[model samples]
Target: MSNEQENPLLQYIFNNPEEFARNLTKIAENSGKALAAYLEPRESGRVQDETPEELSLAVKTLAQVGEYWMKDPARAIEAQTRLWTGYMHVWNNTLKRMAGEDSAPTITPAPGDKRFRDAEWEENQFFDFVKQMYLQTTQWAEHLVEGATDVDEHTRHKAAFYVRQITNAMAPSNFILTNPELLRETMTSNGENLVKGMEMLAEDIKAGNGEVKLRQSDPSSFEIGKNVANTPGKVIAQNDVCQLIQYEPQTEQVYKRPILVVPPWINKYYILDLNEEKSFIRWMVEQGHTVFVISWVNPDERQSQKSFEHYMQEGIFMALDTIQKTTQQSTVNAIGYCVGGTLLAIALAYMAKTGQKDRVATVTFLTTQVDFVHSGDLRVFVDEEQIKLLEDRMNKQGYLDGSKMATAFNMLRSNDLIWPYVINNYIRGKEPFPFDLLFWNSDATRLPAANHSFYLRNCYLTNNLAKGELEIDGIKIDLKDVEIPVYNLATREDHIAPAISVLEGSHCFGGPVEYVLAGSGHIAGVVNPPHKNKYQYWTNDGLHRDINDWLNTAEEHPGSWWPHWQEWITDKDNTLVKARKPGARRVKILEDAPGSYVKVRL
Candidate 1:
């Protein structure tokens, strides 16, 4: 179990011969050349004047090359294989001359020392490489042997793409030339222009002034100031198992219609309460809306046996009960983000199926999907075999580690995250930029083993929820029965939740659905508020007439929809009860703010 004894490369090679041969070849070549030229120290050994400098330069150059190879390794190994074989031949002749009478230095590979084993593994991998080449060559030869026929353009293009994929996988190359032209043509004609427009928009965002703005007409500024003032203060409220920690809002400005905020248990709630400058929670409170967000308990190995049913009962349902009690309201509006949204949808479906529709007034979803068939790239992580492997690992560990979930997200955007760091630190000799978001992103949380298994099998792999075949607690839930007004936001450029996959699919909700195509990625789009030079929103319904009209006609808005949303929510505010602090008899009090469970990391 010690780090020193752990051989990642050995483990990988033993498990995957094809990958080992494809990777070990490069490591072998560099070590071979470096070891071959190392002369034995002697009094008459004439060292060159610039020998040290030459070695230093070679070492530095090879190190730089190593960083580049790490990103697209298949090709690097192939090149390294060729280099190593050449070095081995030269080294053999040198050994013969150096050891005429005396024996040469023993260079036995023990499959544990990185240097010796690396070369040895590469030598063994050559047979695998030859076998793979023969198999592929045979597959390609079959097409030629049958005599090439005139194939349709579509079929030919598809064949060519597969041919290229296989060739790239086997032959490997450091420089990968992508044909974006084909991808461009596949997108809608207007989409091509939209991409260019987005680039300009991104440039504008990068160039925009970050100066603070003042609004004389806004009554909400005082409320936001109050929330900001209490940054280090503790605010806690509880009912049974549901606990609410208000680091900001302590008083109750119970809007006639309250909105429940459901964020993913995988992440902290502070994404909504990020900071005063970009806090959506603060913004909502200032806009005269009562917001209740769920703070999830971070499960440890001890809590690994907890299932999806437990999460629904203890997390979402418990929070809902507390919200109803605190507001003294029969129904409340609901908003769910990411995985929380998916969970909320399941809860809502369950509620409707069991005739509990009076609890929710309206539903709002942010980047959540019910169907997974159209989910892109993420599918690579969940093949049947990989899923089985993941489940087995989770069961062994008692829970799916949070760090593992974080790694998956990072890999989804590896070009933007992992590769840039590798290039900067390893190649360009630069340190990483310190960003709060990246820090928060790296702080991963674990999923209980039982919960993770159910999530993958029921929601993702099966897509049973949207199909109306999903049952929870013996209740056959249907989304169609949950017909409250709905607001669904989808980011145009979200890879995690593609626009077409969610926004277009909202038609299946069978409700008064209002779909908004926001102008950013998953996180940025949701976090964005109405600000100068930020971005605008387009709706399936008409332009900024009214919430009702906007939900009815497809129209484009030129600016932030923050003010419009504020107007819509406040239109139904009550004058009966002012914002008040709840007494012990009226509302239950819990632990200090941010709670014990919110701070758990792993």
Candidate 2:
């Protein structure tokens, strides 16, 4: 018998044909059920029909794009020919190498392309061909996406994204045969790495409730207070939803108006207070600002019912009241990061509608989006079907698990976040290095189901927040009603909150709005300190409706935007006073900074 026929499992299956048939039948039945579930349309009243006017507009847009592309048919043919020629050269080189040629034509990886970095991939002719072919395929796919004119911009973008994902997934480095490092280790260790990987996989499956958990690092390697959120502070106030942390002043004197930082609950609050060097909180404190951050509690089933209104009231409102009372300052300057910025804007609107606009002196938004129309790739996951699936999962768990949410974000940059860790941990049998940022990233926090659902539906899906249709606590909050001077900071490379979307939202406010575009992605842009002397920023006094017009006219400023922000905040008021301690008369110290709420693990 042949090797395949002699296999014990195969022989048994062949002999017990009825049993094999039964198993196949069961598999088919399960697959059909899964397919049915996936195709099922969600029940949502917000979904609109494709009207003739909308269809006409879409058709016109497609035609315009098509006409532009078809203006030069020869150009398209030339590009395709070039790609074909490159593929042919690669195939010829591969065949030559197979015929035992000493030298083979190989393409070098692009700058910063870490995949195919293994010596075997670079030296081995087979792997060299595989890498070159993959690169060529990716280039061709991207060219096709760029050339496509039959679809809308969003559709084209999604197609490109999926194409990249498929190409990345099929990279030779992910396989055992093409992965030199993995092969070397397997031979040296006599397949021990495989056994260890299996063990780890089993352990993770058990711990993660059947989910395949790709551990970024050894969780025990880092602790909350010691290496991570080590900044000195005290929790002066606490509520059901969050705890207010008041960091000890570094300088003798601080700004007269205390700064209240509202961070997104989607992540742990300590991201701002990470380490002293990279910590924005530390930098702000050293810059003579009395900073108070809201540490949102890691919600459990009990807090799943907490609504968006509850977060605004019990979180931001409570913190603001505490800061005002403690510092004895009627108005405090507020800075909001990410979703926290969105919440702050809502609060400002609510306060304005309620005739309490003076509660905040000035507002600063760090990569926040109120206008969801151009919110970037995250919109792909906000549709009715996806939202329904997410809602159902959240309903079952009472809250959205941090890992589950992280998966969606990680998929946005799968090449960077997912594949590297997979190769290092499982394929190469190595643990990820103890990086604080990665550690913090892995330590995600859960979102309360009610609040998350409301946010996804109202803000992202319907985009009521920017339109002033968002109502909270029996009050209609309008962004135009917010008369407070706003400092809107957006990152050029931000995927979550696009700068254009931020610019649109900034225009919604009926006040003096200064929009600044900083370099780098979301987190790095906001946390950047001036001393690092990294990442330039752009600014313009003119407020133009067109984003490109503003970008074209804006003056480029070197280094970090921190100094500019400091100057802006300082210009707000000339009053400076001795720095106040962590807790004041009204708000006594409860616990040290970083706070208990931030340390909670879901």
Top candidate on TM-score is 2
Q: Clashing residue pairs, candidate 2? A: 233-593
TM-scores, all models, native as reference: 0.60, 0.82
Q: Write the per-residue lDDT of candidate 1 for residues 1-602, one digit (tens) a residue.
A: 85324743232223344544543454345334333333322223532233354345334433443444455577456545645554554356345544553333223322332212222222323322332333335344234312223333323333333343334334211111111221122132322222332233332223222110111112223222233222322334543223564433434554666667788867766667655666777677666566667777666677677776766777777766766676677787788888788888888888886778788878888887776666544654554555686787777767776756765676566545544443333222233465445545654677888877877777667877778888777787887776877777877678777776675447657677767877778787777766654776776643242334444565667666556556544544444345533322265556544555555554
Which residue runs of candidate 1 sit more than 4 Å off their true CA positions? 1-243, 246-254, 426-429, 542-554, 571-576, 582-586
lDDT (Cα atoms) of all candidates against the true structure: 0.55, 0.80
Clashing residue pairs for model 1: 75-172, 402-445, 402-446, 540-554, 541-553, 541-554, 542-553, 542-554
Encode model 2's per-residue lDDT on 1-602: one tens digit a residue.
78534652232123444554554554455445433433332223222222354345434544554455566788667666878888998898888777877655545677888886766675566668878888887887677667776656765765666666777888877876666666555554555455455555545544554455667778878899888888888899999899999888888888899999999998887788778788888888988999999999899898889998999999999998888788888899999999999989999999988878899989999999999999898876676756786787778768988877787788788888888877776556566788777787877889999999989988899999888799889887889998878999999999999989999898899899999999999888877878889999999999888889999999999889988998999899858898899767767888887778888874
Identify the leading candidate in terms of lDDT: 2
TM-score attained by model 2? 0.82
lDDT, candidate 1, equals 0.55
Candidate 2 C-alpha error for residue 187, in Å: 3.2
Listed per candidate, the RMSD to the true structure in angstroms reads: 20.4, 9.4
